[model samples]
Target: MKQKENITLSVKNVSKLYGDGCAYCAETDAVLDKNVCPECRTVHACRDVSFDLHSGEILGIVGESGSGKSTLMKMLYFDQEASRGSYHISDYDTSQSNVFGLSSQAKRQIRNEILGMVYQNPVYGLEMDFSSMSNIAEKLIAAGSRNVGEMTGTGDHFLDKVNIPLNRKFDPPINFSGGMQQRVQIAKALSNYPPVLLLDEVTTGLDLSVQADVLELIKEIQREMGISMVVVSHDLAIIRMLCDRTMVMLNGEVIEAGITDQILEDPQHAYTQQLVYSIL
Candidate 1:
């Protein structure tokens, strides 16, 4: 596959620490547990993470529950602050800025215009009590769109795209099935037509059949929209299906990263080999 010349997003040396930066936390050589500082007890949720996402590429970050994949995604979407790092969106600025340094208002603008996120749980991304149309409208409203007619039309279009029938467009997500709710979340995320989409375990809690359908929907969206995506999931099957490139994370570090097929068929890292074998 040929890639475009420009990079969409670049992340360098990103780390998220839960405690104050004590001197002991800085000089620790504890290889066995990089996340825990034996001297100061600072928990490193993500440590020295770095990657580049090109336009129209789907990059997969795969790890277990505590491997910090979710933490990385949170940082990308501004849900959590990074202790140290630089994040740059090429379309927004040529110079990399610490995304954590941005003001709350600026961050909100970035979230509304530049980035779209779909969380593992629909509750985080959608209002259970709000109608599906209203849920999609919330994003447009946040982006300063006040035209009721336009918002409703856009919501209906996206809901249909996600296979949520027009009748359910007015129904609240609380009354919908898990799969339907997930689709609505996807629709809400794509409603803004953001340049980057961040998906965190979107199919984890769904049934196997439902998972397949959601996966297919995601692929279809990616194909039609050509949006760059960052997908974080514990399921290797999801990563294999959605990602062009894969990053294997363990203990808050990327142990291996490369083409998805290469990572699965010829895993070089011990942890990645274990993961691949376990799945097989």
Candidate 2:
């Protein structure tokens, strides 16, 4: 694996392959091993994906569904392990530190302290029964914020920072509007104050107005927080507005990566050009 110079987060030749084709599979006995591991055919969610994220830089990853966008984001969040290559955050080498393959305590520590994630589906990531404040406070608490008052204060601050109204803090995510819920989720992500942020299809299901607002909020937060960001989105307009650099993925491979303006204005790869043209 080749190293990228002075990068906060770097991924080299990473790949994720899922299972042999099967219609039905039996459940496993262990909690972690719930899915059956087959050895017949394999499907690659991500293939030889490589990229670098410098401190305070926003790198946008664009692709169609099943093109490995979400899978790649999951790997960043340590939700799934990469089958090949390595990733580094700050001085921590993911492959060497047992970062992904770690004890629950170790994994939880790294996840809470170093990384923050804003998922595509807000409802899916959030607790429907808990208030937005509770959802946000949980992550902060896990990340080492002790006092309830402090947690609540920090949660409120983040919610305000993400532009979610304070009045909605006690409301359950299910009760809030889609955009509002997404904002609350963003607040939760920032509550821990992680140096690296991963956003996956956050604005996909939003309306035009909400999308604009959400994108703006993200941009403002990135600038203020000065954290490295990896945003996975299919929306070209959002990418153009928010990203400093862009990577175009096709069929689970990165076809192009360069300055956002250069790729958007004059893409070199045929697939990149096609994707940009289709959206434009």
Candidate 3:
């Protein structure tokens, strides 16, 4: 889609090469000979990738594993820096913010306040040992909210917003079902009220029935919070339900992107069409 000044996240010329191999040549080497191996090969996880994430819009990144969807989300969360190019959040140049270059304090500030990440692995991002309320409150405190009571209050409020009952607030995620844990994670992600929410396959392990509920909760929360989101998932149905725009990626590049309905209804790219068919 076209870039806009209202864009909350702008990634331009962003590329990531894991080792010494160049991005283009690495692909060339993989293609001509399937068995060919390059030493310390540069694995281009993301290729000169560019896209705009507008405010209050849920932009879904759909691709199979190894397709760079996760890597792109990592870059968005400032979990990793682009090997080349830059990402700008709001008016601040993320490139200049030096996702990798920032001081520990600066990076922490960005992470704790500006961006919130929900992972496919529930246990990975949240405090498994803590109660849902405790986990959420901790994040709010770290984000510079000195009012502990207020943070706790907001935490409970968000939990309810995400449909987590007050009775379960003190339960650790370990005892919760996959769906409930996901809800708690979503609550924690929003506790600090970050401007951006990055969800990496947040529905990976749920059954179809559970997935639907979680997806609905996400839509409701997104609508209420009015924060931008990047949802990474291979599930076309989920993406179709949640995103305003959807981007199709393959081997680290965005092959197609447009309004969710447009891409789902009339895909322009062959790969995109293939994905839509697969969904059918």
Candidate 4:
């Protein structure tokens, strides 16, 4: 028998609601208008979203705008607190504790040492006014690196891996193009070599050529570094290129999930079928 793959990250019943939910929202018999509770107008950004990311796996979350995919990504990165959920990283405390329940300090440590995030908007992930090298150094410093030489070396290594020219490393991200800014964000996210990487629409606004290059870079990183990644993108083409398995989210709920090829070839959900066919 084949040995079971280790689960790098696990989440159970994760939810993020923007308003106080009403009893109707909790009733299985009640109808919801999209992801909103009509009775309370509570925006259920993510309702019971859960998944397991295996070692060295690239899992994709795909959905249209406002489908809660970004919200789920934010919750995974601890950028947005989950209202209810149990999140555990196998490499952290043997996955015995729900990270969401940890103290702010502990969560910060986890963010620095275990989880790395690249947001859809570069503004959320990069310090535009800071030099590209300084942005990377900031992450290293947070992860407990105290030696300037070591930090500088690490920053150079990652920036180079992402194809950012050494000569421009000292320049601020504000001086770079959108694609270059995203590359700097990627370097910063990988500076500490976190075991799990969360990417939320990282290629959203880039030109087609740039998007392809970014996606290729992500694949190279995963292959060489063995970093398990959770990639969120609405574009099915991007998912097809980067993900091994995929989950389709609609109205804040995962409507279907399975191996990426299976979903592309035989999407079961109506929304998912529409999504897959639209790209053809």
TM-scores of all predicted structures: 0.95, 0.87, 0.89, 0.97
Q: List the residue pairs that clash in candidate 1.
A: none
Candidate 1, position 231, lDDT: 94
Better of 3 and 4 by lDDT: 4
| Per-model CA lDDT versus the true structure | 0.89, 0.80, 0.82, 0.92
Models sorted by lDDT, best on top: 4, 1, 3, 2
Q: Worst ten-residue run, lDDT, model 2?
A: 25-34
* RMSD per model, one decimal: 2.1, 6.6, 3.0, 1.4
Write out the backbone clash pairs for model 4.
none
Q: Please write out the lDDT profile of model 3 over residues 231-277, one tens digit for every residue.
A: 99998888998999999998787889899999999999898898899
For model 1 the local lDDT of residue 276 reads: 91
Predicted structure with the largest lDDT when compared to the true one: 4
Clash pairs detected, candidate 3: 21-42
* Candidate 3, position 60, lDDT: 93
- List candidate 4 stretches off by more than 4 Å: 1-5
Q: Candidate 3 regions off by >4 Å?
A: 1-3, 22-40, 91-100
